[model samples]
Target: MNAIQALTYANIAIWLGIGAYCFFLAKKQSEMDRRLNSLILQSKTENDA
Candidate 1:
């Protein structure tokens, strides 16, 4: 393959890698948010008792 074709494939691979990383980070953040919300609710309930 020519240089341009190699570069194009490399660019696409880099973008796909970045997209996968972002998706992983988003899933982690969502899990953390759910845990935090449950903790807040638990604390509120404890204080009321």
Candidate 2:
């Protein structure tokens, strides 16, 4: 392959890797938000009781 093609492939691979990492982080953040909301609800219930 030519140098230009190799560079293009490398750039695409880097972008794909970054996209996958961002997806993973988003999933983790969603889970954390869910857990935090659950905890807040529990705290409010306890306070009300």
Candidate 3:
């Protein structure tokens, strides 16, 4: 392949990798947020009791 074609493919691959990483991070963050919210509610309930 020519230099231009190789560079184009490399750029596309890099962007795809970045997008996948961002998606993974977003999923983890949402999971952590849910866990934190549940813990906060549990604490509040215990204090009320």
Candidate 4:
């Protein structure tokens, strides 16, 4: 492939990698939020008792 074609492919690959990384981070954040909410609920329940 020519230099321009190679650069295009490289750019596309980099964007895809970045998108995948962002998706992974978002999933992890949501999972952490769920766990934190659960802990908060448990604490509130314990306090009420």
Could you estimate the TM-score for every candidate? Answer: 0.81, 0.81, 0.78, 0.81
lDDT of 3 by residue, 1-49 (tens): 9999999999999999999999999999999999999999999999999
Q: After superposition, how far is residue 43 of candidate 4 from its true place, in Å?
A: 0.4
Residue 32, model 4, lDDT: 100
Candidate 3 scores a C-alpha RMSD against the true structure in Å of 1.5
How does candidate 2 score on lDDT? 1.00
> Residue 45 of model 2: what lDDT?
100
Off by over 4 Å in 2: none
Q: List the residue pairs that clash in candidate 1.
A: none
Cα lDDT tens digits for candidate 1, 1-49: 9999999999999999999999999999999999999999999999999
Instruction: Give the distance in Å from residue 25's predicted Cα in candidate 1 to where it truly belongs.
Output: 0.8
Q: Candidate 4 has what TM-score?
A: 0.81
Across 1-49, the per-residue lDDT of candidate 2 in tens digits comes to 9999999999999999999999999999999999999999999999999
- If both were scored by TM-score, which would come out higher, candidate 2 or candidate 3? 2
Clashes (candidate 1): 0
Backbone clash pairs for candidate 3 read none
- Candidate 2 local lDDT, residue 41: 100
